[model samples]
Target: MLIAQVTDIHLGFDPDNPAEFNRKRLDQVLRHLNEIRPRPDMLLVTGDIVDRGDAESYRRLSVALGQVNFPVWPCLGNHDQRENFAKWFPEIPFVDGFCQYEVEAGPLRLLVLDTLDEGRHGGAFCEVRAAWLNARLAEQTDRPTVIVMHHPPVEVGIEWMNTDPAEPWVDVFRQCIKGKSQIISVICGHLHRAITCQWEGTTIAICPSTAPQVALDLTPIDAEAPDNRSMIIADPPAFALHWWNGSQLVTHFDNADEHVMLAKFDKGMQPLVRSLMKERPGAE
Candidate 1:
């Protein structure tokens, strides 16, 4: 099974206009996905779908995602408004104010977790949500499962960004995932940069954003300095392709410009031409 993951779209950020930097970046990502030789089985948008908690943003997101041909699953991020999201995406499954859902693709099970805390940068899974996760894990203890969330459970080394107050929620998540050999990986995307770490014997992968990337700075910035110190670089948009072959999950980071070709080539002379090029002008 092939699954494509795109995150941190930040749509509807510019309310008065249709064209915004983040929206255009999202369009690029969608275009890349649409042109793939073989489309993925499903597309997962981890979170940060909008910059602000507004109904209009959610409406725009719904319309934009309508272009996708495969199944699209979304989870709430810190910038998202749950009520607005639910109103626009009424088809999405949610329980006890948490957008947690399970889907079975062949022999693999996907567990989507909601860690949004409404008006904060970090995330948390409350008691109700934790119980839901535990119950789901117990029910499918025999099947290979992959947990998807917005905020990563482990720290990403960047000291300031690591100040998320969701540290308390890690224990609950650990308790549920520990001793579960069936779990293949924990996939997340909040830190706008590709990051990976190990937690409870499971691999945690934080995907890069499809928009402008966050600058990889470890310094603690001065509070008096303007918010400009936060991010940097307008990187090319990208996404992750996860291949589940029943036993192990292999991931490939795909960029829109991944394809490059040699203009001129002869099938039989290719190796001879390369060997000739390596030889000296008069020593061949």
Candidate 2:
């Protein structure tokens, strides 16, 4: 299964302008996904769908998403308003007022969790959400599963954007799937940058944002000190492709901009490609 992901699409950043930058970035990524061979089975929009949780923005988002040819599953992010999201995306059902659900793909299962704690810039996985996840995990013990959410429980070293390891919700989330081998990976998007780490026995892959990316600065930051370091940059819009090769999920990241091809499967490169292919055990 090939799954495409785009996140942190802070659409409606400029409410007055019809042609917002975020929307264009999102469209570019979507168009690329559509044009790619072996089209993605689905697209996961991992939250921060809009700048402000407004009905108009959600409505506009609905229109923007129509460009995609694949199915889309969106989770709640810190900047999202559940009610407004429901109003526009009535197709995405909510369970007991939370945007949490389970999707059964051909050979894999997707458990979508809601971590949007309104009024706070961080994530939250309350008892109710934890219970929901635990129950779902209990239902299927053999199938490979992927947890999709907006806020990643693991800290990615971006001080201002990191998820504190000591957070209570992180503990609760950890306990729910600490030893569940069924979970192949946890896919997330929040930091506006691509990150991967092994957390609680599973891999967590953070997809890059379709909007501007967060600057990659690992320097320690002091809130009181005014260091004018770059926090965000207008890098090319990016997306992640998760390839499930029957046994494991492999993730690849790339920007929407077309790359200048340095090599192709032409006569000039045929021998190189053949030589590489012949390296395999069974290759003739």
Q: Which residue pairs clash in candidate 1?
A: none
Models 1 onward score TM values of 0.88, 0.99
lDDT of each residue in 86-204, candidate 1, tens digit only: 99999999988789999777778999999998777888877899899889999978888999999888877676667343587877777889999889899998888888778888888
Q: Which model scores highest in lDDT?
A: 2
Model 1 lDDT at residue 62: 88
Estimate, for each residue in 146-240, the C-alpha lDDT of model 2 and write its tens digit: 99999999988889899999999999999999999999999999999989999999999999999999999988999999799999999999999
User: Candidate 2 at residue 212, lDDT?
Assistant: 97
The C-alpha stretches of model 1 lying farther than 4 A from their native spots are: 163-166, 220-230, 257-284
Model 1 TM: 0.88
